[model samples]
Target: MTIQSLGVGSGLALDDLVTQLLSAEREPKEKRLNDKEERIEAEISALGQIKSKLSDFKETVDEMRRDSDINGREPTITHPSEDKDIFTAEASNSALRGSYEIAVTELASGSRIETADAAYTESTDQVLTDGLGSTTMTFKINNTGDSFTVSVTQNMTLAQLREAINNNENNFGVNANIIDTGTATGGAKLVFTSDVTGAGNDLVIVNDGDRAELDSLTTTDSTETATNLSPVKSATNAKATIDGIPVESETNEFENTIQNVSFEATSVSPLDTDGITRVTSTLEIGYDRDGLDKKIRDFVDNYNKIISDIQSLTRYGESDLEEDGALAGDSMLRGISNGLASIVGSSVDSSSLGGLFALGVELNSDGKLEIPTTDFGLGTGDERLEAALEDNFDEIAKLFTDEDQGIAVRLYEMANEYTSYSGLITLRERAAKDDKDQIADDRERFELRMVSYEQILRDRYLNLDQTVARLNQTGSALLAALG
Candidate 1:
């Protein structure tokens, strides 16, 4: 007899036995795989966290490694009056530390030209005659040779001409508009303004087509020999005097006039009571002490932040009940922390400022950077930092940016070694993932084996069921014959 289910013939609980056996075989192996996978996942998470922190620290160090950012110039202007500003000035790193007296005489201006009185009877008046076909008006700046053309159709109105000039794609800073003077003498007058500012650089509109009807909008005569439009304002250069020495610029801003300093004239300086001599303002160029100080403080903060993150990621739990850190006992974190500390503590040969110590930056008991309050014969951290900024300001840049042994340079290089595309952290993450994949394979194989083991158990139970069923039938037949 064939048994359809386990224990059907024997009336025994073989199904429960098969279930218990499978459970016993699967529980231990599954628990091991689960524990291993959890550890690898934690490792991956910890690696990502440390890599992110290092990248941030590297970016900050990258900026600090540049000398231009550390060595800066501060320009201060003191006008004659408290309310009015005569000019604004900026200085570069190469600017010398000095004071100058500047007086602004004139501000730079652009040219403004307007059409002759009643140039057009109305805004709708035709600019080109019906048989004139088309006219091309060219706008030119005399000194700069910058020019653009406007195409006027034969039936184009004065308003349409203004739109064409303004809408030209090649227009280099020329603006055209019409103003209604509200009378026949000065009817609708078209105005042309040129942004080209300099003495002798005038806006000269040419009647390229030589059409007399378009002469009202042109600066030149029909024969291109004389002026037709009225000059409202002339283009002029900005003028100022430095220390009684006269200077001029095409625009309001004077660049490199004082070596590496540039200043923009806002308005004419105040005149004396006689209205002849102009009052002067004082401009002083000095080292950007406050800016450098802030950068230094920021560097210290960023360094400390990275250190704190590494510490948190690598620390171990003290008690058995507490869980350990994801990266506990990891050597990579220790190496990174130690490497940064070593660079921060080491001295540089390039800068006269020596090292971070010269800037009053110290490593605290917790192995983090700080500006301490304690004084050690030299001065308190704050006092030393202030003195360094006041005295050896420029040398401070070499301490952190020098190519050979700069703190910032070395720190950046070290961080890159660990966080780069194929760096140590990335390799560690890959290896952890590989282990996880291996565990997954092991789990799949174990499941396949469990399936085969269940089949074997069911086959043995089926035989047991058949044997018991045959014996019961034999015993029942024997008892019935005896009765």
Candidate 2:
């Protein structure tokens, strides 16, 4: 049988009374937790935003650091194949985590090309079959190497064919255009041109469509490996050495190689012709201190608030409205509340990070993570830390950022390892949230029950009022009759 509450009546059910008391006892606690969660969420979101900004800021600082070092060396970029001032450098490292040191000469020009587009069967130029003006075909472009095919309609208008050719930009290395000859009898003619300038990979028009006695050239699109680069010479031609290993260059400078070698350019290298000295460098890609602090503060405030609610529900003092709280002495709630102690002392190998502990980032007597210093300001210990970093960066990056070993990564993995209901923060947090949600559901049920009780009480009162009025009228009538 379904149970419903009768709020008030001449007679009351024991179950209804208990339920009303329970609602009063649980509502406040759930409300406390919900309010706490909102504040925590705000803090978390604020932290995330700040951290993102900080990461960018850090990248800017790093770039500045790079630029500040020997004035950012200008490097020339080039296409792989081409006969011109071409330079190359290579670096190799036993580990994956260090920056490069190079002396690069700026190239006079950098050559690049767009990948080919798809092919289609709707042609325009004299390149198409006769009487196929209304017909259309299609094809595709390949990046590594390869020419694509296209067919034009017979005697198609130059403008119409040009449109068709341009329409198949995917297959063509170049875009097509129609030129107005300006002659009274002349109309626009289709012209195909390359988007890039260079000897290698220069636009080559292939005979993909039938010439039908126009001289049938049978071949598919072929990969056009580039040749002839721009005037960017290797500075090492004069003299260069990589980590004391003497290296040779034919032109001005070497760049983008895996090796951490520096070239001693004989004179002031005119690498960047743009004369643009300062360019914004690396893009920042990590979190910052303020963001982290905000997260920490949020966790603290939220955790505290949840604690307060739990205390409110499980141990309401005499001063509280309720003498005995609804969840009082619930072992599960108390146990869950205490589970927060785990992360506070969550251990990471202090030595693994190389003097990570000496920076006033310490473990307290009670085994909690402590940063007596205001910031994760390893940057302040710049000179000494940098000196150390020069030698141990790979290890340091590994301990703090590597997916398997970094603190953040470890915490992230742990955060999702939920034994019960899954959540982001801590197990205790998950438990508290789950508890709060559960109680909130109970509160909803209680409110529904209260509505039924209110109706029953109203009806009972009405009946009593009517009965008294009837009795009064009957008594008056009897008295009059007796008189």
**In each prediction, how many residue pairs overlap at the backbone (N, C-alpha, C within less than 3 A)?**
0, 50
For 115-147, candidate 1 gives per-residue lDDT tens digits of 888768888988888595887888888678798
Per-residue lDDT tens digits for candidate 2, residues 1-483, read: 111334222233544555666668657866875666664454344324323432333333232222122122222333223443233422223312333223333322212222112122123334444654433333322222544545555655445655656676465454555445545344333334443332233344433333332211111222323221221211113333333334444334443233342222333222344784211111111112233233333333443444555455566457766465545565644553454334333344543444334322344453333445344555333333344344443343343344443443443333234221443223444455566567568668866776776666555655654555566668889999999
How far does residue 246 in candidate 1 sit from its true spot (Å)? 2.0
How accurate locally, in lDDT, is each candidate? 0.89, 0.39
TM-score: which candidate is best? 1
Error of 2 at 232 (Å): 22
Indicate the worst ten consecutive residues by lDDT in candidate 2: 278-287
Model 2 RMSD to the real structure? 13.0
